[model samples]
Target: PFPSVALVGYTNAGKSTLFNRLTGAEVMAKDLLFATLDTTQRTIRLPQGRPAIIADTVGFVSDLPHELVESFRATLEEVGEADLILHVRDIASPDSAAQAKDVEAVLEQIPTPDGKTRRILEVWNKIDLLEPETRETVVGQAERLAREGTAAAVSAWTGEGIEALRDTIASLIDDDPETQLTVEPHRGDLLAWLYANGRVTGRETDDDGRVHLTVRLHPAALGRLERLYPDVID
Candidate 1:
């Protein structure tokens, strides 16, 4: 399975807009509550042609009903299974911090499959709405957050700070394991995937027409490569 990301946040935090911005998939990104009721996913290609699946989930609200909870089991499950979680926040909202707590309250109920603390990257969305003074503060905070791979400030609407956001996401999820593998000349498809999904440090073609490659890949990508071409590594 591809590495996965889930977008979770309070209603009208611009999570859906950010989702569309990242994945280039047009799902409902309206101002209405619960505009994205179901979990929608699309493949997102990162800076190096590495791909991951990103899911846009239903927006969270304060005091969600128990009955409403049952209706969103799938969305909850999808969030639980994510390799990374982007907690989108409406930075311009007066109650943004409180809303973040509300969303976290619900997230605490959903157990991750691995029983480890989930890696959540805070996304400060709708920065375009911030006043100039407030924007300066948020930008400073974002820069600090970016250093730790913990947060990003962006206006998904204007596409501002998106490239930086992508770089942050890549860094946060990187496994960075390097490997050596040889590919038969016949399996050029596998060769292409390795170059796309990984950093190829060395390459050589033998008289036998096999391509030897020294590559650094994320663990998830490496596992997928191994599964896709079992003979390459041996």
Candidate 2:
């Protein structure tokens, strides 16, 4: 499986817009509430050429009904299984902070298989709607979060600050132990899997009919591919 990042936030927070921007997928990103009710998964190519699975989930709401939350189990499960969480927030909204808190509360209820919470990267989005002074304040807060090692900022609508966010995510994913892998050409399927799950950095073909490939992939995917193609790696 490819490394996954979950786009989560309160309704109308631009999570879906950001999802479309990052993945280049055409999911419905309306300004209305609950525009996205189910989890939508799309393959995204990072700036570094690495592949990641980006999932856009239903927006979280304060005082949301238990049944409503439960109905999104399959969608929420993506969060539990993700390697990173993009906590998208509407920086322009007056209740943005409160909405973020609501999202956090919902995230708290997601159960992971290893009993460990996913890494969350707070993303203050929609800066295009903020005034100059408020934008400065919001940008300062985002910088502070970066300094404190917690979050980042971006304008999904205008594509501002997106490069920084992508770089940050790339760094985080690179730190994961599961993403390092080596492959040889004999394992065509493993090569395909690597291409799907990670970025292929280098490849060379030897005179002896062997192909060598260097890839950075999620650990789970690497392990599974290795088992399927034991002779692929030297």
- Best candidate (score: lDDT): 1
**lDDT of candidate model 2 versus the reference:** 0.80
Decoy 2 TM-score against native: 0.82
lDDT (tens digit, per residue) of candidate 2 on 1-234:
567788999988999989988877889988777889888988777766877778899888897777877888888988988988888988889998788888888888878878655788989898889899989998988988876547888999899988888878876666534333445446667667767766776777777756666676666766776787675555
What residue pairs are clashing in model 2? 178-219, 179-217, 185-211
lDDT of 1 at 92: 95
Provide TM-scores for the models: 0.87, 0.82
In candidate 1, position 53 carries an lDDT of 81
Our tally of clashes for model 1 stands at 0
Candidate 1 Cα misplacement greater than 4 A, ranges? 184-186, 195-212, 216-231
